[model samples]
Target: MKLIEALPIVLSCQNLSKSFRGRHKQETVVLADINLEIRKGSFVTILGQSGGGKSTLLKLLGGFLPPSSGNVLFNGQSLKNNTPDIGMIFQDHNLYPWMTVEQNVGFGFRIKGEKPGNYKHLVHEILDTVGLSHARKLYPHQLSGGMRQRVAIARSIVVKPTVLLLDEPFSALDVQLRRRLQEFLLALWSEMNTTMILVTHNVEEAILLGQKLVVVGSNPGRIVEEMTISDIQYRDRYHPDFLHVQRYLESVLEGNLKEQGDNYYEEVLAISRIQKINS
Candidate 1:
């Protein structure tokens, strides 16, 4: 077994489902029977299109939204509500416009009634790690989109959350900036070893960052496919194997490859072999 597979399960959901009551008491099922297990210190990416309940699944996992049925387990305990141990970052930076970078990153400590002297060093440390130490005095309006996002991330990680749930946090940035942030996030995860689950509609981003990728299908979102990718080749966007898998996943998301089961793996492995021979 892979080392990541051997790690203890840090978070999981059992038969998790969520529904909302709409007008005339109509029930709209956003998610159904989502059973997932995240390993300790692993990076898991959830891929799906918009309105596919990807965000809802993330919220349910984080206890930001309660599941209509089933349970979210954290460290083997059923999660009743959002806990500090699980931090969340959304697509929007959602920074405090009035607070400077330093103040904003330190807000988590302040909200917990911690004194400045208690968390000041921690706030500085995280800011430096995120490459925002020099921008500590800048307010939200003064920072660039990427910088604001970095501050938001710093804010979440400064508290040392065991798991971080991100909801398309880089979707708004330009392609170049998005890639940079993806690398930044991966580096931070490596350093912190925090189990990270990020939900995104971007296929390349999902494969690039995830050790495990779970694809959620729409029409009451469900896991259509789950893949464990360990090969470093998958990390290269231009690699033949990487492109093959990306195209296959794209087809799956577009509802074209539903019946392609074992053939998918065979094709990907075949491509890997071809590349190895050519190299």
Candidate 2:
């Protein structure tokens, strides 16, 4: 295994920001000055509340949306536009209803104008890698939520993009299924060595998957805290250090409950004002 520090930065974001037009015709900022670097083959996870700008950041990195300020760099070039070097998987399966699992997995290659025969072996290999070999002929509707997600993952990774962006990919699965898929993804990452950025609301999931965990908040969504999980003892989620970090993050989000007297109203009003303006 290559030392983490020796891995080159595969993606970078500098002073990234985004805003939406408010109902009052003012700009409601969702993110501001977001700077991040994803090392080659590293897994970075962004975790936040439901309304936080996690999804927006993911979209920006994936080239699905333009940043209001700053730039995203892929390799050494500015990501001023979309490119095939990035691939994304959303919460939705997003497979063509008419296409079989094999076809969907090969869709990226097909769109690139590659002949089926050229990518046929690769597609089969990825399907098996994702443990979906038995259901290669199934369609989206014919599969369970977990299975569909596996197909989506297969599709994204089949192209072997330099970076993979995922937005809550296993959010719809049951607890057991989600855990299973998480293990599968970690194993797959070990084998393929792909750089990945995942946006999720699941704290445990973030802790388990990320080499670094970024906590984001809404209303000019900026990173509030970044925790390195490299030393986390994953085998014992209940370990003292693990619990301590979890509690720290939870407190960061909920604020110090004991000090909610005079400052509570101000914080409440700040949130309310943003919502009223955005609404």
Candidate 3:
């Protein structure tokens, strides 16, 4: 076991629920009565079906969205709005087309009106950590999908946020690329030791990246399963225990409601208030 119980609780949710008025003014419930506690410097994965409020929950946790009922606390304080202490990354890179790699990575500081002299060292350091120092001069259009995501990850961490909420940042890549980025993410997590919550529909990725796997069920989405992966040997994809866990999680996801409907997503996005690539 990792003895996470002894660690400080970096983030927590209590009786959380999110809903929004539907087209006809009916409240469409997405997530409800969800309580969670994440230890500091831990990697947690939130897994569920598509449109199952995974992204919505991530938004709530990151303070990117307000919950309908409950509260999200970071280091024991309620999150009212977005804070620099919590960084969010969407599936798309969301890098500026006009900005070069170094510029994009340095943007967190730039947004705060910090001079390049202040953030130059930090940006270059993170870019090199993600193996993108060579691409610092390249534009977003010039990078591959995996490279783009790497930049997004780099951008989020460059600020040294206490928590990094990732919303399927690796889902868009090819299988091979996805695997590579997964490895890269794990390495980043190891180096930074930041509290991370990754929302993904991929079972294998969830098991691989998370020390604790949270399986959320749909239809008024709630966490239905929580598993702690204590053994370090299970990190191997080819390990029998890893394969067994993957199969079990696949079965769990297969049993959930296949869809959350247009109303669900429509209401979700409206309430979540999350920003994406095009935006």
Clashing pairs in 3: none
C-alpha lDDT of residue 275 in model 2: 32
lDDT of 3 by residue, 41-76 (tens): 888999999878998999899988989998999999
Estimate TM-scores for all models: 0.92, 0.88, 0.88
lDDT of 1 by residue, 1-279 (tens): 135667899999999999999988999999999999999998999999889999899889899998999999999999999999999997675889999999999999999999999999999999998899999999999988889889999999999899999988998799999998898998888888799999988999998998788999998999988777767787799998789889888987988774677788578657545543442
Clashing pairs in 1: none
Superior candidate under lDDT, 1 versus 2: 1
Clash number by candidate, in order: 0, 1, 0
Candidate 2 lDDT by residue in tens digits, 1-279: 324455798898999999988889999888999998888998888988887888888889988899999999999788977778899996565889999999999999999999999999999999988889999998889998888999999999989988999999989889999989998988888788788899888878887788677889767688877655555363356876556556556665665634546565455445434432432
Best by lDDT: 1
* Residue 56, candidate 2: alpha-carbon lDDT: 82
Q: Please report, in order, the local distance difference test score of every candidate based on alpha carbons.
A: 0.88, 0.81, 0.84
Top candidate, metric TM-score: 1
Q: Model 3, residue 93: displacement in angstroms? A: 3.1
C-alpha lDDT (0 to 100) for residue 9 of candidate 3: 95
**Residue-level error in angstroms, candidate 3, position 223:** 0.5
